[model samples]
Target: MTAGSHDETLAVLTTACAAVGLDPSGAKPIRLAENALWRLPGGIVARITRAGQHQPTERELRLARWLSAQGLPVVRPLPGIEAPATAAGRPVTFWEELPPHTNGTIPDLATLIRQLHSLPRPDFPVGRLDPFVRIRDRIDAAVTLSDTDRDWLRDRLADIQSAWASLPEGLPECLVHGDAWTGNVACPLAGGPALLMDLERCSVGRPEWDLVSTAVKLTTTGTISKTEYERFCTIYGHDVLNWPGYDTMRAARELRMTTYAAQHAATNPAWRPEAQHRLACLQGHNGPRPWKWMGIV
Candidate 1:
C-alpha cells in the first residue's frame, strides 16, 4: 500500500475516489511533492499524503473551513465529501478545483499575508511551527549526496537549530503560513480575488518565519526584482531584513531549500545539478550571495 510509485499512487487515488463516490477514470496528476495531487473529473482536486498524515490532513481541512468562514479567500474542500479518508494507507482529501489562475503578485501575497496575520488564533489546536520538520530526514534520505556533503549539511542543520533557539527578540508569535511563496497564493485569471492555497503548514510561529521566504528569494536567489521586494515589504509592513534575526532565518531557509532539492534529486536524477549547485553555495564553494538558483518544480 506504499504510495511511492505512480501505479501505487493511482491505486490510492482510485480507492479514495470510490470512498467518496467519485469516479477516478480521468484523474490526472497535478503535482507530486509533499503530496500527490490529481485533477479529478468534475473540477475536483484530490490530494494524497504520505501514510500516517491523517491528523495534519484533518487539520488542513478544518483550517480551510475556518478561513473561509472568516471571509478569507482560500481553496475549499469539496462539498459532501468526508475527507482525509484512509486510502491504501495514505490520507486523501478532495478539494474544489480552482479556475485557471496565475501566480499571485508580490503585492497580492503581501496583502494576503498581512490579512492572515491579523486574524486571532483558531479555536482548535493548530500546533506550533516546527521549522526543522522533515529536514534531517531529507538529509539522510538524499541518496545523491556524498557522505562528506551529508555530514556538512548535518553540521549546518545543527548550527541553524541552535541559532533558531536563541533568535533575537522580534515580532510577536502568531499564526504563520510556513510556506508563503507567490506560487502558493493563486490569482484568478478571471480577475477574481486571489486565494490562498496549501494549508498543511499553517501554524503558529514567528511572523518572520513567513517573511523570510520572500527575503531569501530577493537576496539569495535574486528571483524577484528589488522593486517587487520593496512593494512586498511596504504592504506587509515592517521589513524582515531589518530584524536582527534575519540572517539566521535566511540561512535556515536556504538550507531547507537545498535539502529539498537534494531529496528530490534522489528520486529524479535530472534535479541533481540544481541540488548540487545549491549545496555548493551553502558550503561556500560557489562564490558569495545571490547565486542565481533556479526554482525546481
Candidate 2:
C-alpha cells in the first residue's frame, strides 16, 4: 500500500462514523504507524488499517474484546457495531475513546506488563512472540535496502535467530503485550490507573519479550535515565539484562527497532539516518552512552 496521507485517514473516519451513525467531520487524527487512529465525536476512536488487511484487523478486534472481557484495563471497542467495516478500500474499527490523559511512564508500563503477565492464558490461540519472524518480515517489507544492506541484514538475522534458539528460556511464559514500550501505555482518566492501549501485538509469549524493548532502549539509547531503568527493573522484579538470554533478546529487539525504521525509510527520508544508526549500533560500531534515535513520526 502507498504510505498513507491524511486523506486516507479522513476517508476511513468518514466511513466508520457513518457505519456507527456519527458525524465524520469531527474525526481527528491520533497517530499513524502500522495503523491510523482518529478520535471521533462522543468518546469513540476509529482505527483504520491498510486495504485488504481483513484477517489481521479481525484478530486485533478479537484480542481487544477478549482483553476487555478478562477485566483488563484496555481501550474498548465501540458498542453495537460489527467491526472492521469496509471504507474506501480499508478496514475500519472503532474503539471507546480514552479520557483525557498523558502518555504513561515506566512505572505505569511496569504495572500494565505485570497485570498482563499474571493473567491466565486466553482460551483462543494467539501468535507466539517470535522476534525472528517479525525481523525477517520487516526486512522483506522494507523497500529502502541497498543489496549490500539486505544481505548484511539477513546474515545478522540468521546469527540472532541461532542465538535466540540456543538460549535457555528464562521467564515463565504467559500472554504478553507484544510491544510494551511506554508509548503504547496511557495514563487513565482522573488518574485511576494506567492502561494498555495498542492491542495489535497482544499474544501468548514469554514475558521477557515484552521487557526486552524497554531494557534495550535503556542500554543502547540514552533516551531514558538509568534511574528510570532501575525503577522498571525493580517494579518488574527481574533485571532482564542479567538474564542469560538477554543478549539474544536485546539483539532481536534492536533488529525489530531498526527494521521498523527501515520499513518507513523508503518514503520518509528522515528515517534513513535513524535506521542506519540503529543498524550500526547493533553491529557494535557505536560506543558507550548516548546513541540517539530519531522517531519516524
Candidate 3:
C-alpha cells in the first residue's frame, strides 16, 4: 500500500484493530510519515508501517519492554496484546497513548540520549546503524525532483556514503537511539518523567550518532539557539560538534533530512517548496552553513 493512502491505512487499521478486539470507529491520525499513527479509543495508539516491516516492528516492541525493565523511560506497548498483526500487507503494533504531553525540551532529549547511550547492548540482534538505509529509494521515489536534481542528489549521496565509511573515531559504541529528536521524546503534562518514544531506529552504534541529531540543529539547520544547544551539550556531557568526525556525520544527517522531505513531497504536494528549498541548500544555492529549514510535519 502507498504510504500516502489515508483510506487504505484506515482499512488496515480497522482490520488490525478487529484482530486485537478493539474498535476503530473513531480512530484519529496522529502522524503519517515512515509510519502511520492513529489515536484510537481507550487510550491506545496504533502504528502501521509498510509491508515487510514485521521484524523491525516486533523488535521495537521487545526493545520497549526491555528498556522499561531496565528502568529507562520509554513508551510502552499495550499490555496483553499480540502485536505486529498484519493487515493489507502492513505491520501493525499497539502502544498505550501517553498523557497530553508537550514536545520534549532540548535538555530532556539530552538526558534521554545520555541514559540510552549508557545502556548495555541488547541480547537480541539489532542491525548496525545503516545511515543510508532507504535513501536511494527515497531519491528515486521523489516525484517532485527533476532529472537533473535527481542526478545531483545521487552524486551527493555517493559522496556522503564514502565520507561515512572513513569517519574518524569519536565516542565508544553503545545503544544509540537512531533518531533522537525532541519530537521523539515526550514530556507528560500530567506530572511524570519524560519518556522516549519511537524505537524503530534504536540500535547499537556510536553515541556520537545520537548526539549529532541535536548538534546539526544548531550548526546546520539553525533551529536551536546557541544557548539551548550549549545546554543540550552540557546536559549530555559531550558536544558532538567538538568531535573530529562531526563534518561527515553532519553531512549524512543533512542529506537524510533533505531526501526525507523530497520523499514526503512526492506524497503531499504541500511539502514541495520546502523539499526544493532543502535540495537547493544542499546544492550550494543558499550559501554556507546554518540555512533556515522549516520542520516538515
Candidate 4:
C-alpha cells in the first residue's frame, strides 16, 4: 500500500516466515516486482502481497509447484501458509528459494525450450486467450495505442478469425510455460541446466503458442537474428506457417503489456516509456520493420 515501509514490510515477512516454522532474524527483502520478497539465510523466501493482489500471487506459487511436479525445473513453493493478515487484511505466501543457474548459455537455452516443447499439453481449461478479448481488455485498461496501431490489431484479429477453422486444431495441445522469456529463466545450476521461475501464466494451449511467444521475445529483444526465427521452428520441430498468425498474437501481447505498463506507470515510469515504444513499433509507424528482414515487403 503506501510504498511499503521497511519496518512494516519486514513485519509481514517475519509473520510469513514464523508461520512456516522459520526464524526471520536476519532476512533481507528481495525486490520482485511491486511485492516484497524476503530471503532467509538458508534458501527460504517469503513473498508478501498486500490486499487484493494475494490471490494472484497464490496462484502463481501453486502453478510453480505444479510445474516442478512435472519435473520441469521450476521454483517450488512451500504450501499451506495463509498470507499474513496485514492492516490491509490481505493474504501472503512463501516459497523455497531456488539457486540461480550460473550457466545460462545459448545451448542451454535452446535445450530448455526443446524440453518444454517435448512435454505433452496439460489437460484442463486453464484459460482462453483470443485476439479480440486480449486487445479489448488492454484498450479498456487505458493502454495508449495509436489509431493505426489499433487498426493493425483489428486486421490481424480479422485474419485469425477468418482462418480459425483452417488452422490446425487438436494436433496436440500441451501445457505451456506461458511466460518463458529469458527473464523467467536463470543460468544453469547444480548438475542440471537452466531453471525457470514465475509460472503464474502457465496454461494449456497449442505448443506453438509458447514457441511463438518465445520467438517473439527473442525477436523483439534482438537476442536472436531474424533468420533464427525459422531456425527455431526447425529445431523445435513445429509447423512453420507464413506468419502462423503471429501478427494477431503479437498485437494481443503488446496490448496486454501496454495496459500493464500504463497501469503501473506511476511507480514504474520506465515501463511506460517501454510500453509507448512497443506500441509505436506495433503500429508500424516509429520503428524498424520487424518482418522486413524475413523478406516480407
The TM-scores of all predictions, comma-separated, are 0.96, 0.89, 0.96, 0.70
Prediction 1 TM-score vs. true: 0.96
Better of 2 and 3 by lDDT: 3
Q: How close is each model in CA RMSD to the real structure?
A: 1.9, 2.5, 1.8, 5.8
> What is residue 39's positional error in candidate 3, in angstroms?
1.7
Candidate 3, superposed: residue stretches over 4 Å from native? 1-4
- lDDT per residue (tens digit) for residues 141-236 in model 4: 434546565566556556656665455443366566665555667775566557776655666665555665556555554546656655666666
Ranking by lDDT: 1, 3, 2, 4
Encode model 3's per-residue lDDT on 141-223: one tens digit a residue: 99889999999999999998998888898888888889899999999888789999988988888888888999899989899
**Whole-model lDDT, candidate 1?**
0.91
Report the alpha-carbon TM-score of model 3 versus the true structure.
Answer: 0.96
> Which one wins on TM-score?
1
Predicted model with the maximum lDDT: 1
Q: Evaluate residue 34 in candidate 3 and report its C-alpha lDDT on the 0 to 100 scale.
A: 68
* Count of residue pairs whose backbone atoms collide, per candidate: 0, 0, 0, 7
